[model samples]
Target chain A: MIQRLLLLLFLIVFAVSETADAAVKTIVLDGSTTVGPVAKSFAIYFTKKYGVRVTVSESGSGNGAKSLINSSCTIATMSRAMKEAEIAAARKKGVNPVAHVIAFDGLAMVIHPANPVRSLSISQIRSIYQGTIRNWKEVGGANARIVVIQRESNSGTQESFKELVTGKRMRITGNSETQSSNGAVKNRVSTTLSSIGFLSLGFVDSSVKVIAVNGVVPNEKTVKNGAYKVTRPLYLYTNGQPSGLVKQFIDLPNTPEGKGMITELGLVSR
Target chain B: MNIGTRKILDRSFTAVGIGSIVVMALALMIVVVPIVYNGIGAVFFTGTVEHRKMLHAEFKRGDSQNLDSEVASTDRYRAKVYDMLTGFEAELETMAPEKKTEYTAKYAQVQSALRALLGPLPGDPEPMLTRFKYGQTRWEKAEEKLHDLLYESKWDNSNSSVMSKEFFVSRAISFEGTSLARLFPYVKENLENMLHPEFTFYWGFITDSSVDSHFFGGIWPEIQGTFFLAIGAMLFAFPLGVVAAVYFTEYAKPGFLNSMLRSANSTLAGVPSIVFGMFGLAFFINTMKVSESKSVIAGALTLAIMILPTIIRAAEEAILAVPKTYREASLSLGSSKWNTIATVILPAALPGILTGGVISLGRAAGETAPIIFTAAVSVGSAIGLADVFSSPTPALSWNIYNLASEHEAAAQLRHVQYGMVLALVTIVLLLNLSAIVLRARISKKLKC
Candidate 1:
């Protein structure tokens, strides 16, 4: 019985390895939850148009960098550019990470649609996140305690928000609740009257009211025209200059169909 | 300190025991009732004509002739809505510049709301995403979208002392003088005619792969992945765990080393599951190069390690529970030690060992943390058995988290998340129920 079990195990390993070798013309993407939707849509369209299989994994930007360094994925979709340390790590592994800007996403500060406070300066928003401005009244709103919502540490959107609104070195208050994704953050902000959270421009809907940042609203025209101050370029990193199916995938945003998908999802095409 | 006082205390203690059991039962009910209730909505709900259309187009299920007739009937009502929109647009083009500008923005809002309720407008390009290719599939969601179309929801914060309240302003009221005013009431009255909703039982929620980030389709990939991961872990851990248990119960002598090993087994059980996840990544994927990255083999190995201690403890207890008379009778009958253990003790202990195995199997299936770093992906189609070593697949436990908290349209896909939770719960319950039945059958056979 033991011998038969061992034989079965050996057969499985052999079969898996054989199939793995045959798995060409397939693109594997790993990265940001922010970029996951776009990647998934593109994968579906790409498979339909070209008959090449595409699979996406939303493990977060940090893991995306790691996956690229490890040569596990063909493309690493990210909402933030790779950090200096990540580039150095990739270099050490002989993987030259190249970034391709796919689309532009504006980080919109959203609150409950009922909130009296419609706008906040960058510093005021930073102060609220830092816990110095605890009550909404301090920021020209009602006397309720501010419910600050943040994305998880691994999220690229969180990193981008930190860089744009709060300084990278500044610590977010312990009172802030950390949600895992943009949808979760939107859900919280939409439900809680005193809550404030940030989401990608594409996720903004009437469920939550988008507040002005630096006196400019985040919308397609504003973000595209550079009037939106908190805009960031979404990226897809490859090990080197991409080739073949990877090249075509990285070039998707340049195509009309891909551009339409980006606009439909609420991101602006560069 | 009298007999009567002691008897009163004993009765109170028994009452407390019963009270605690009742509390536990109530707590279980509170947690399970909502899950089962909402989870049922995933499979059984009022489906609109759009839903049938989506199924016919995507899954290639349903009667095409019936669907075509339904579409044609719905289109007759929907055409009036489109005509009203065009009439309002033409009225705007002939108005004064400032009035046209004012009406244009409001008209744009009305148009988008209509697009959301129905599919894309006539002049709009074909939507690239599958979600936009069809209108609301579920009647409940379609009603919510209709509310969004008929009225603009605004928060009432005039009195600032309390929380803000949401109130709606009718779009028809705002567009009183315009042709669009008639559109809202017309659509509201004829909604039942426009989208013929019928009670639908979508067993396909269990068998079809999701489309466009679970905006549509089923969760077969997650279910298949969970089964693969759980069964794969059992295949690796069962033999090793049972052998370890037999050695601990029958062969290991009571010594300092044996005591330390026993302590280690209990310690392993107490460690946090997340620690196993981190270790799985560090040891299996990074150091051992298990299938190049996160794969089922690596995840199975990690889960096997996590459940090993429990299996060992349970199997050891089962081996020990075999009546001493059985072993003695075998020995007296001139059987060797190994022979007695193999033929008599193990056979007697099989049912109990399987009970523990079944419980561990449920745990392995339900665990999310260990697989997150090793095997689970947020989105992937059902993988074949041969791909287990190289590709990561979506498991129910992990995808449940992804769908509920991370998917782009999480609010809209609450039913999908609930359905996934129900599927996982049902699978684990069924596994346990089968174990109970198997145990009863084995014990009955032994009695005979």
Candidate 2:
């Protein structure tokens, strides 16, 4: 009986190895946690239709670009444009990295639902993240401690937020919680009454009230027209020029199905 | 197999042990190596000086071809034909529409003639010729440099550098209309955009903190948060676990209490860290009202509970290993059981207890699941040792998770993260190694 069981196990293992040896394609995406929902939705939607499994991981836009440089992933889901250094690295690896705009994202400044603050200027937001503004009353809210929340270093949303809100030079409050994803931050703020955080427009919901940046609420209309200051393009970076399955994946943003997926996932289609 | 062959075979088998060790080592390496390899470019960060010099070199060499006043630069040649671009770009911000078939004939004529005449310039030559073909501003900026020589009455063929009349026939300097000479200072300064320090490396995001300006200048608060959380966890878990282990092993009833103790320990270990976090959020953070869920106390308390089983097991073994002779002698000398425990047994078991504590510390240093569930705040105030109870602190592990998430910070911190990790591992190793050495010393001193 043991011999027969062993024989069966060997047969199964041999069969599995044979199939594994067959050319299987994997696409890895790492980037903005804010852009994660749309990327994940797209990956699942595309894979089911095309039968090509695509793995999606959100480290931040910079990490996405970094992944492209290291050849760890085929596609990098970025919330920002590539730097000259990243481009040079890709060229070194004989893959001229190209950016494909998958979608447009509007970064939304969020406060706990209890916050009565309606609007803030970029300078005011900068003050909050910079730890200079510690009281909610300073920003037209209750006399409460202003709990500042931030994304982890791998989040593209935070990258764009740094450029727009803080001029990339300010420091966040030291007592910041660094959540790994947009959902994590959003969820924390929703549960914690005194907290404030930011998320991609897709991750915005009723639990957290969206505040206006410079009196502009992030929306499809505002972001599309570039009226929203916290808006940035979502991108996919590949080593060299993308071709074959990779090309098809990159160009998905241009297709009707891809657009549908983006819309369904609550992100603005490029 | 002969004796000589057998000996070689034995040596070969032993060498394969390292291969297994390599596999194990590689397994550990993957968690760090892939990310390190991905972020290696960030380590080669050239200070602002190198970046500035390279840009300066490129800009100077860009115009090296036509030092002569008569040689029409592309920007000057394009400025002569600026009307075509200005009209075409009126429809869209991007020149995508201009790249269509309608502008091709004129585009072809203008491009071919310019490509042949100017040959090439510095920096991204292909984009202007292809992707950004209708981006007349880039050409206009280049052309504005040539605007001086473009439609001049002298029309001396020259390089794009401002005409000092040395490189041209217009030695008299007799231009009446607002000469492009007035704009030379502004244009020369504007050209520096090709090489200006990009603030992206510092700015974490649109809503960046002030630290972005200082190039990740300091993380004293986050460092403080990490230190106190681990210390607090050790403070809370170590004694509780050791006492529980001692009581269970030394004094508990065999039939019911032993079974119950075993079941309790296994169950405690089996419980997911998230459930503990939920419990902490509800009990300590919310009900007890010590601080917010993101406070360091919440994390420390939760992690203490999480690592209790590990501490208990290690302590139990250590306590059991204590020689019975010491306890017997203490009892025979009219000492109470509690007295013996406090004096003899506890002192002898101190090294084992320390080992258990350090092992728990190492686990706490790397644990994400419990912290993620507990007091981890996305952003918190600057916490310090004094603020350990009230403030939210980001630990080393969480910092890595955070660093890998923010693109701007990640771009700049790849090396810092590795260095930070190296530091964290070194500290943990030191703590564990010290415990090990102390264990050895105590064992020798006690002659156990």
Candidate 3:
């Protein structure tokens, strides 16, 4: 009985590996959670139109870079451009990393809607995050201890926020609570009376009031016109220039359908 | 000390024991009741016409004819809304540029809120996202969207002594002179006609693959992935664990090596789950080349290792608990030692061994950390059995975290998250229940 069971297990494993070897036209995308929705929407539309299977994984921007370098995924959807070290690593692995700007996202500084402070200069925002300004009064709000919220380090949104608002070398205060995603940060800022956080502009809604940075609100026009200093371009990276199905997918953002999905999800069309 | 004092102490000890049990039960109720309540809402809720329309369009599970009629009825009421919007736009076109700019911003907010409530406005190009393809599917959400349409939520920071308070200002009041002012009251009165909410039981929440990051459809992929991972872990871990237990209990001598092995087992049990996740990624994927990257086989192997110490410990205890008399009698009757151990000792320990297996199975199914680096993907379809070695699939535990904390629409998809939790709990409970029943039957047979 034991021998038969062992034989059966081996057979099953062998059969599965055999079937997996069968070539199917599939495009695999791995990367930033911020870019996941856009990638997924494009995959759905792409599959329907071209009859090819598309799968996406949201591991993180750093891991997406790793996947692309390892040649595990066809496209790496990143909210931030690849770092120098990552590009060097890809080159060492005989992979030529090329980036395609798919869409633009603005990081809106958000607070509880009731907070009287309507805007903050980039310097004031930097001071608040750096733990120098611990109270709302320092930023012209009521006398309450300000609760700082930030995203986990792995998040592409967090990286972009760091580069845009806080200096790259500066550290966020330890007192800040780390949320895992944009939705979580928005949820925290909306519910907490004296909390502040940044979110992708698409996630800004009625629940959280977005405070202007440098006296300019993050909107489609401001982001497009370069008035919104906090905006960053979302990207899809491939090894060298993409070809065939991957090329079609990389070109999705320029298509009307892709642009519509981007706007629908509350991102700026590039 | 007297006899009376002894009796009093005994009574207090009993009371303390019962009190602790009561507290534990209460704690379990506090955690489980809310999950059950909101989880039920995922299936049984007041669904609107849009819900039926979505079901027809996405899954082809509803009556198209009935859905068409529902659409026609809702559209009749919706036409007035469209007309009012057109009238307001026409009214804006003829106004001064300054006035147009003022109304345009506020008017834009109203238009978007209305779109959120009733879906894309008539004559707009079709929305590509499944979430935008339909309006509010649940009547409760519809009412919330309607409130957003009617009122602008504002914060009252008048009291400097406290945090700001939220207050609503009527959008109609803001638009008093415009045709859009009439749209608010009209929508308020005709909401029931526009939505046509009916009590619906959505069994498909369990059976259908999610559409567009769970904005619509079901959680079939997550449920199947969890089953595959848990059962695969058990299949790999059970036999090895049982054999190791037999060696420790029946054959191993009490020596330095045996004690060291025992300590190693305990140490393995105490390792944090996340450490196991990191090890799995490094050892299985990096060193062993397990399917090139994260896959179900790698995840199962990691979980099997995580649960192995527990299974071995439990099986050892179960073997030790079997009475010595049966083995002695079999040996005295001229049966070989191996025969006596297999027929007499093993049969007697099977029930207790199964109890341990069941508990470990539940742990394997519910654990999130070990699989994060090995097997779980945040989003994927139900992969075939053949693809388990190569594909990473969505499991209930990981997706629950993703949907609750990471999904872009986390706030809006609370029901999906709750439903996923309930499904996972049910799956684990059913597994334990079957094992319990099997153990009971086996014990009864042994007694006879």
Best-fitting candidate, scored by TM-score: 1
**What tens-digit string does per-residue lDDT give for candidate 2 at B178-225?**
222233333334333322223223211111211321122333334444
DockQ of each: 0.40, 0.02, 0.40
What docking tier does model 1 reach? acceptable
Off by over 4 Å in 1: A1-26, A50-53, B1-7, B157-164
Question: Candidate 3: which pairs clash?
Answer: none
Give the DockQ (C-alpha) for candidate 1.
Answer: 0.40
User: How large is the C-alpha RMSD of every model relative to the true structure?
Assistant: 3.4, 25.5, 3.4
> Which residue segments of model 3 deviate by more than 4 Å?
A1-26, A47-53, A70-72, B157-163, B333-337
True contacts kept of each: 0.40, 0.01, 0.40
Q: Cα lDDT of all candidates, in order?
A: 0.88, 0.60, 0.87
lDDT of 2 at A136: 77
Regions more than 4 Å wrong, model 2: A1-270, B1-16, B26-45, B49-210, B213-215, B406-413
Candidate 1 per-residue lDDT over residues A179-234, each given as its tens digit = 87888898899889899999998787778999999789999999999988999999
